[model samples]
Target chain A: MAVINNKNGLRIEKADITLGFIPLTDCAPLVIAHEKGYFRNEGLNVTLSREASWAGIRDKVGLGILDGAQMLASIPVASRLGIGGPKIDMISAMVLDLNGNAITVNNDLYEHLYAIDPRSEFSPLIAAQALQCVIEENKRSKRPKLRFGVVYPCSTQSYELRYWLASAGIDPDRDIEIVVIPPPKMVTAMTDGDIHGFCVGEPWNTLAVQQQLGHVVATKYQLWNNSPEKVFAVSESWANENPVTHQAILRALLKACIWLDKKENRKTTAKMISQAPYIALPEETVALSLQGLSLKHHGQLPEKVEDFHVFHRYSANFPWLNHAEWFISQMYRWGQLTTPINIEETVAAVYKPALFRIAAAAIGLESPSIDRKTEGNLHEKNMLMKSQHIGPNQFLDGQVISVGGIIKYLEQQSLSKADIPALRLINIQKEA
Target chain B: MKVLLIDIDDTRANKLEPILAWTGIELIKLNNHNTDIYQLVGEMHPEIILVDTNSPNRDTLEHLAQLNKASPRTVIKLGNARSESINRLAADAGISIYAIDNIPTKLLQSLIDITLSYFYSIEHLRSEIQSLKPEIDARQVLNNAKKFITETYGLTEEQATDLLSKNANRQGRTITEVARQLVETGSFI
Candidate 1:
């Protein structure tokens, strides 16, 4: 497919296209790109469709029903590797945002956690230990296992929830029950006692806190600073067929990310996404993350945490292969990926950093030269370092889990019995 | 002996009972107004599950997927508008059949039998692919690819096979190459 140099002097193959996005605050970039005319400015006509779930987005994009989508960071990788469902080779040219998810628990659980440890640190370990105590008491009393909800099986929410719980010695699979619930229904599920807590993106977390049904226990920033969240993903075949259009989309989204990073424009963005056609949540609820204000917790004053929702800064939009590796490790650790996989090959195939570089260069936005980096390392000077452990990659257990370390951890952790059937299926397929 | 039929709107549910009466199969009507359909499916392990809705939303699809995972049962979904993505998801989630457009009362028994037979054949093919050992033959791969294409595009088997060969010829590649690509990528041209 040759790129046509149009009258506008822009190299584009397809202008009119449809993009899918779930109704979440992090979908701001896609909405702003459409509503704020960034897409039009880039000589593209983009229609944003609100999908009900991540599976819908994945399937629609894989089947070419939608050109692309705002997807969970792990989705493209999982889809490509056939982890959760069928294998659909998806590529992520740009990341949508970073660190907007938080874990929230019902008021009763929050009260129990507070009674165990009332420190203001919001340490994942302390909260997990308290949960352990609760689990033990429930076991003594013959209560049902606590159920936790996540948006999708192969999402960052599930990984973050598993990571937090695993670090505290709680077996996510054996000790508790984890279920998949849509983001909009998280609050109602928690109120109905269907789920004890949930890990999801805003403004559901904010809404839960606002409704006094639950309190924030840990933000993704605390778990892993500047963690990659959602991405603009498309099928690999689609990207190859319409290279120019793909680059144009990346360019438009880059401009939107830059515009969103501006401090003064955040309030406007929150308002814009709060409209009916977009996120359709209250303006105040959507604005909380953008404002970077303190979040409410049960039996405690609001806690201040900056960088709650990062759109562009810290090279957030760059699709790093290292992040993909981390997700792959999590998938293996959680038994989602039953068999061994080539981590580097799978990650490189899914994350198109070269396309991101081209789009960023077109807009004169400086992007990282390297595609891989060490995650969980937080520091001031080398925040965007590509390699050479520039900062602290510590988890709650004081262990800095790197790619190699995670592989070892997976080896040490036995695969749960529940995953045996899936593994057997894979084994059968491999034998054939 | 038993079939579970769930429809939130009583219109389609009422019409389904008369259609299944001739089969002598005991039909269990479930009030889909209840939100916890997944839990209900677990409680009542029916041989077959049927759902009718005006439009199948993500929630309904997700619940169906959950039911498929928790209990391996044949599921058939009937909706008004045809959605390629929904059909693909149904296939991935192990749903036997997803029929769009209004149901013709006269065709109910035949459709049910077709769905069950298709599901059994697919299951048999999966096991055959497994037992073949070490190398899945081209014919098996082609059969699976054709099945995927027919499901995704709502095409007949012959049409899907013709499309695969035509695309392969256009690309100057063999049918095996094209069929393998389709099976691996889960996509069709």
Candidate 2:
């Protein structure tokens, strides 16, 4: 029962590790890290298995069923705090990618966003405004406010959607209701009119726009440039026993990042990720700009270079404590979990910079010079999210009380039957 | 308070003998296949209703939704649906809650009391506090049926719940009864 630390743990470089990944667009680096022979190059043996759900991914890692897996950035924070289901100490050795997520309004909503704004000129911020406006306008028309979807409760997709919506003066809870939907079904849900819109990660976002079921109103990276998204994660115990293996995997994955980010590899990577076995998306839907260039949205080259998914280059491989803590701050803000924790120590423990540094130095790259200071622009002064009424920059994480009493507080906010019409709609609709 | 316990398996009545031991309530178990359980639920007007998960006999939650309008006094307990994520997600999406088996004796009674007291009222909510004296306990059973269907079949919350309801009803038993049918019969369908 002694505390876990580096003193007596098994070195990661000495062990072979099994990594888990889901077949999403961003799992590319982890898969590519293995495919490109980076693991072998770094003196590590790695195995990759595709998982079904984020819960399965978390549980397998928690129970030591798998060594580690690709995880949403919020997962490590949520798992340690024991938020979503159970608490198992997990850590991130490196960020998998950023951006590549967008809020797609259903076709009806997209058309309204375009037609209603007198200045039909597109802005994620305006589309955000339009979404809020439509909800309010619907209230006047007595139509039910929209119910939007996010992939999971503990995800950047939910937070970013809330952040993006709030920036536009929309109340995420009141103006619209947010629920979880699996990523693969998001576009179909939008097309079927089961949900008004959704915030999800890659290929799906691309799917919505291409199918004309929805439009990408906001990219997570644009809302907050280089915002931390997914991570390559492992359980604390696994990391402890397999330190050498962990470091080797990180080094290998870092090399894969470098290779994936290159212009020549970008096209091949897009085609590979889009295959039926991966995201099950058509290659045309996932076609990243063949030139390894930036995305063109609304006839504009997004001013943010980090708006698309980033595998290698920059400080991508160096797991930042700030990046991890920022999500804690967000979890606190969104009331996902209660109370603020010792952000510095917890984030530091979870980010696993020691392993990251070892991996980086092994790959002949300089580690990030910034050791502790926060990165990225937390201040979204220029952005307009859909749920703006919940904001005005005061308590941005929307955390008033600390994380200590979160469940009780958030439970109090649970919707009553009167708040939204009871789900007897099936019966009512069945009769009607 | 009185509870109407409807099970396709007659033995559950024997198993539940201890559950209704101390409470100021009467437990009535109807395991017969031909019983008009839904009509009886409305007629008897029990404070809480417990139906077998396998009842091809009834869509208990769906019936609860309907009963809530005519007789808001009756609250139905979908006790066996808490085993899986798809079930949990389905319950959460449907704005209801279920209690799966294997809960501790105390917690199980507390869950029964919560349903007996009705969830929305200040009085039932008042009972919720006393039941957890030291501190509030928030624990729900891990619905295996939910986990089984979601992981094995990749079914959504709505789909999994619907499939369970349909199969159970078609077999003319409770959902728990039908679930066991699935398990005992040993075919995934």
Candidate 3:
């Protein structure tokens, strides 16, 4: 029964908070939050319901099977906008991590890029352009579009890579393609050259760079500089009914994020995330991943590290409305939003910034990037929105442009017989 | 039509049915040979697809990934987000984050709305393609007719179209049928 003022009383006291999470290194927050008495601190019992795919999480959440989850920042935006599937209203409460993802090109392509340019230097923007040039040149000789991999469609990596390439003037739809590959299989998949590169989080990016199979072309930090990565999202009703419980959970998580940011706690926190039940890779793998953040042994550009994944930096925890606006812009730019959106109201409704502020105040936490309106231009080369800014134009950079209605723009250039970019899979395997 | 459970029965499964009912979600079950996961994906193309995390099926995640592209806007369901094993599988499949249930119905709808809002573009893209097929086909036929006129009348392609348009007006019939009649019957009908 729906909760009324004082008569029906909410069942949240006994309600289950079935959280879902993917197994990537970034999933550590959910694990740490739950494992470290975070959920209990909030007088709540949350079942850490691990899931199969971004699809699975969405479905379970839609049908009320699971409550909320650690989701791709775009997932909430996509779900609410209903671009990938049926419109499912969702939102991100907290910005989990940042700058964990990277673009890893396969060895053959890496060598091929070098062979063509002969200057295997450290310019991701130029390399991206060079890669596009190679794809275009090869197109004349019947070279099929090379496949690149991202974790999911509703992932920042997908948009980032697309945005990155588009800024360099490469059409993601027609030029180098992106396919979704799980992090575990990313390296092996890259080896086959079935996928030329992949954009993924943590150990995987470190894994690729360490193996020398590929190099990091760009970090997500370069894409949007502290863009929301992932979040522990639940249904809005759940939070509304269980206000104190929600605050408690946030308080617990507040501790985790604080611990994660500490220089002394990094080793222990990394160890915890790399646990057998967690990211279960070798300690060395986890160490390498953590080391890659600061160390430059793996060809990772140190310059990108300054604005890398700041766990508690710059209001990362604050689910600001402007941040919502930024994502909405991205949704429109990427053809994720089909209809006209009430971006302002939608942002207010989707983002629980007020709740976040309350939690931040309770926890006595200070967020970096005090102003969410700072319009920051991404370092990657996504110029389709040359004059489009994904977020509010509040950053110091005048280069920021609005991503308003870029989908309509891409559609105008790429309308189908049906007047929309209707994508069909290249392979329709027979039911064998 | 009831929403298919897409999995076998158990306590959790049985409880799921009523819970969904309470939440105003009426889904059915199709755990039999009639379970043409592919054909159903093509025809029925359910709004939501629920798959078990433990099922030994050929990476249903992969299948759903492909289906996501084909089905256009259908959602594929999994149990929870904490299932890292399954989450990895789903991520690799190109599915969007439609729903992640662990909170309450409000959060679920928030996620759903997010999914719906996000999917609108791609789904609209699908509808756009679906709606314009006939027009495109007609245009193609019109082009073919224009080409035929270019060869027969020894006129340029542009001149042939202009000639066809003028003649079709004189015939008092549709240009497409007139163009077809001219090409096939070798005379204007």
State the C-alpha lDDT per candidate.
0.73, 0.60, 0.59
Instruction: Write candidate 3's Cα lDDT for B72-170 as tens digits.
Output: 233343332333323333333222332222334444444344333443445678999999997897788788888877887889988887777888899
Alpha carbon lDDT at A410, candidate 2: 28
Error of 2 at A383 (Å): 19
Candidate 3 lDDT over A174-249, as tens digits, reads 7776666656666777766657888887778777767777777666765566677787676666666567656666
Error of 1 at A99 (Å): 0.4
How do the residues A171-242 of candidate 1 rate in per-residue lDDT, one tens digit apiece? 888889888787877788888888899999999988898888988888887777778899999999899998
| Candidate 1 segments whose C-alpha is farther than 4 A from its true place | A1-11, A298-301, A380-394, A401-432, B1-34, B45-189
lDDT of 1: 0.73
lDDT of 2 at A140: 94
CAPRI-wise, candidate 1 is incorrect
How many angstroms is residue B100 displaced in model 3 relative to the true structure, after the best TM-score fit?
22
Docking quality (DockQ) of candidate 2? 0.02
Interface RMSD (Å) of candidate 2: 12.8
Cα-based lDDT at residue A347, candidate 3: 64
Please write out the lDDT profile of model 1 over residues B71-180, one tens digit for every residue.
Answer: 43212222333344345433433232222223353354465554444445667898888988535588888999999988989999999989999999899998888999
DockQ of model 1, rounded to 2 decimals: 0.06
